[model samples]
Structure formats: C-alpha cells, structure tokens
Target: MTDDRTQDAPVEDQHPQPIDDKVAGILVQEEADLAGHDQAEILEALRQRFADAGIAISEDELLEQSVRIAGADGGDFSDR
Candidate 1:
C-alpha cells in the first residue's frame, strides 16, 4: 500500500514541538502570561520555571535564547 502522509505537512505539524526542546522559547514568547513584566523580571521567573521543569539551562544560555527569540520576533514581547 502507498503511504498516506502528505509531503508538505509532516505529522509533527499536528502536534507541538517536544516541550523540553522549546520550553524556554515558549516561556519567553509573548503568548505566555507574562504581561507588564520587564526583561529582567521575566528572565528571573523563567529561570525558576526552567528549574521547576527539570530543565537545567544556565542563566546565560537562557538569556541568549530569550534574546534570540526576541530578536527573531522583532523584540515584540507585548501580550497578544
């Protein structure tokens, strides 16, 4: 029998990325409930959250990823 999966839309598209791989980015994104919090405050909270989630990312690494994500999204961290 022929495969039914479409080439353009992989199975992963139907699901969220593995949480561990994206936990930091997802947390820093504007979509999270982080309204009105400045960058420093957000990062502190994120550091705690990461530890709580058992993801051992260094503060520098977390800052780097957050900056990267913010830059990629035009630094627009306003609530959606």
Candidate 2:
C-alpha cells in the first residue's frame, strides 16, 4: 500500500530527482573537456565563469585540486 502524500512531497524535502538525459549529456561533455584539457586552463575557465556569475571560490582549494590534476597530466601547478 502507498500513501499519496508521500508521492506528492517536493524533491528537496525528500529524495532528489534523477538527472534527465539532457543533463547527463551536458555532464558527459564537461567531463570530457576536463579530461582532455590542461588543468590550469580548465580551472581558470571555471574561476572566470564563477566570478562573472558573482560567486567566488577559495583559491587555496582550487590550487590544491589544480596541482593534483596537473600532476596526473605530467604537469605541475605548484609553481603557479
């Protein structure tokens, strides 16, 4: 037996909705770009977009991840 109220609950108040096909496609493209590009280039583009959107991210964290990604690509972000 199922309760109708449970089914009517908003997603944020319960489980998140599954990502639709269009969103999945976008995610795939973004991931491919991340993998195929330089880490600093990718990170810089992300920072610029967020800055233009009036959102800010911590430079320390971004540098940390950038270094990790760069190391994986035979490059280094430490000197940056």
Query: What lDDT does the true structure give each of the candidates?
Result: 0.58, 0.49
Q: What TM-score, over all chains together, does every model reach?
A: 0.44, 0.38
**Candidate 1 Cα outliers beyond 4 Å, as residue runs:** 1-31, 65-80
Candidate 2 lDDT, tens digit per residue, 1-80? 97666556645437554435333333234344454467777668556644653445578755654455444433222222
Whole-model lDDT, model 2: 0.49
lDDT of 1: 0.58
TM-score of 2: 0.38
lDDT of 1 at 70: 40
Worst 10 residues of 1 by lDDT: 71-80
Question: Per-residue lDDT tens digits of candidate 1, residues 1-80?
Answer: 98896768646556657766566465655324454446666667677777765667777876755554444444455432
